[model samples]
Target chain A: MELGLVHYLILVAILFCIGILGLIISRNIVKILISIEILLNAVNINFAAFANFGDLDEAKGQVFAIFIMAIAAAEIALGLAILIACYNNRHSIDIEDYTSLKS
Target chain B: MEVLQFLFFGMFALVIVISALGAIFCRNIIHSIVSLVITFLSVSGIFILLNADFLAISQIIIYAVGITILLVFSLMFTTTKDDNKLWLAFAPRTILAFVVAGTLFILLMFNITNKFTDFNINPKSFITKAPKESTIELLKKQGTTPIIGKQLLTKYVLPFEILSILLLGVIIGAAVIAKKDTNEKNRASESA
Candidate 1:
């Protein structure tokens, strides 16, 4: 069967759900960051698919995806630095251990 | 006739799902990072399938190559194999997560069903159109890359400049955070 726009949307939805599951279930801080990447990719898929089929404006989605990648790179750098600092202080990367800072 | 597209979609979906599962279920953080790289590649493939070649290349280069390597290097310094735990502890938070995710999925499916019910499912108009004329030709006709380059320099120049500054700030912030203070007694020396 030919894959249509709906099929792509469904695929994106499923991938997004999996990404969300990863975000919720993974306890390792690094894994959580990776899950966030997955979620961002799911959004990218939707944007590109819409640009391809629903509209002819491919540049819009491509440009947006480029911006998303830049933001993601910045986010990863900042997050990893913070994580490293946390590890330096506590010697543990567990999210559970971060509760001491919780108010 | 369209079996190739279906196969591509199926392969992309499989890679995305398996890599995501690997990222979630793996006990080794490094392994999860590798799986995330795979997931990023698969997503890039999907972008190509959607006819966004530029985004696909950027996704692979930026995400798989740059970010994943940065994460893995950070992981190396942060935790040793001996100190790493096999699995994370589960608690009431897991239950809450399941409930929230399930509810959101149901709501999403409901919305999709309602919205797409009346839409025509035909794929011919979109599929049969040759890619050369539709995208590449149009882009060439419009001097696409140059247009984008000009916009990046002119209209969106502020955001472009701000992004460079933000990246510089992140570099400085990271250096400050990761630098060890020599004034204090180092942990390794104290332990030795």
Candidate 2:
């Protein structure tokens, strides 16, 4: 069968669903971060598929994906740093452990 | 050529799905991270199939290599033992989460597959019949990197500058938080 836009859409849909599953099901905070990355990639696939097959003149989707990557990087860096500090204080990285705000 | 295209798409889809599953479903943190690496690499492969050359390489460099390494380094600092089964706690919450996620996915797929025939409802672009080969070549000639350059400088200049400022703040905040002072926190981290 010839490949069409729908094929790409279906693939993206599956990946997005999987990402959502990971986001919800995973216990580890790091795993949650990875799931968020998966979710972002799914959106990126949607953008690129549209940019390529959609009638747009410019690849705006690719540009947006790049911006998403930059934001994700910054967010992850900040998150990891905060996690380290949390671990330093509580001596644990598990999400269920830390229940304090003033620490 | 069409067959080759189908083959490529199928292969990429398979890789993406399997690796993504491994990344999420794996018991070990290291295994999950490794699976994430494979998932990213295959995503770059799909980008190449879509003729997004710059995106393909950037995805490889930034995601597959850079982010994965950063995550691994962070993992090294924490001492979550592999022998501990505490991470896999099964509860009523897990079941509830799965039910919610499944319902959401089903709803989205039904709406998407049934209602939208063609996503691109852009009237102007829809009016003209641009041949596929020519458009691909046009994208190549116009070049994605330059258009991105133009957009970042012109239309998105404000957000771009603000993001840089935001990133600077993140770096400084992270440094202050992670910095080793001659204190109990540092001592705890050092001994842990």
Candidate 3:
């Protein structure tokens, strides 16, 4: 079968759905963060694929992907830091334990 | 050559999907993180296939190595031995999650594939534009790094600077948030 743009899009859609599933169902804070990473990766694939196929001259999609990578790095750094802070306070990594703001 | 390219794409896509599933479902956090690394590497392979050579390298550096290390370090800092069992929640909301994700996937697939008919029969009529041959030739010869750098400095300079600022803020914020409070320690010692 010839690989087409639809193939990449379908693959990314599957990855994105899996990411959403993980984000919703996982109880571990770390796993939630990993789900976010997966979602971002799916976006990156979409951008790169478009850059390759749609606009190879400017490659603006790839530029946006780079921007996304930078933001993802910053996000995970801060997310882990917050996770560590919460772990220190409660001595637990479960998301259900950190529901103090739910009131 | 065309068949070879298709085979490579299939391999990378398969690896990406399988590893991504493993990353979420693996019981041990370490195993999940390892699976995440595999997924990232496979994604980089896809980038290479898409001819984003520079992004492929950056994916290896940023996601595969840097992010994996940060995740492992966070896991080490936060987990006890018992945390291994803290994988999935068996709550009723788990079913809700599956439903929502399934619906979203169906919606996206329906739209992208033109109600699932275009996927196999008319894949070429999708959102993709025909790439200019000269640009492809230039990309093949010089690679994408210089193009990316030029774009970042010219068209995306403002966002580029903002990203640097964001990184600085993240570094400081993480350090502050994770640091032990000296005041709490002193008070506990005095009360003891």
TM-score for all models, in order of appearance = 0.85, 0.86, 0.96
Question: Per-residue alpha-carbon lDDT of model 3 for B74-168, expressed as tens digits?
Answer: 88788889887787788787999999999999999888877777756236455567778898789778999989999999989999999999999
> What is the descending TM-score order?
3, 2, 1
Write the residue-wise lDDT of candidate 1 on A1-103 in tens digits: 8777767767777778877877777667887788788888888888777666654533555556667778888888888888988887888877778898688
- Please state the error at residue A39 of candidate 1 in Å: 1.4
Worst 10 residues of 3 chain A by lDDT: A1-10
Task: Give the better candidate number (1 or 2) by lDDT.
Answer: 2
Clashing pairs in 3: none
Q: If the candidates were sorted by their lDDT against the true structure, best first, what order would they fall in?
A: 3, 2, 1
Superposed model 1: Cα runs more than 4 Å off: B82-86, B115-136, B139-151, B185-192
TM-score of 3: 0.96
What TM-score against the true chain A does chain A of each candidate get?
0.91, 0.87, 0.97
Off by more than 4 A, model 2: A101-103, B82-87, B115-134, B140-143, B181-192
| Span of ten consecutive residues with least summed lDDT in model 1 chain A | A54-63
lDDT of 1 by residue, B1-192 (tens): 589988998998898888888887788777778888889889888877776767787888899999988988898888777534735448676776677677777666566555435334433334423344556677646533454466577767888788889889988988888776665557667878
Error of 2 at A16 (Å): 1.6
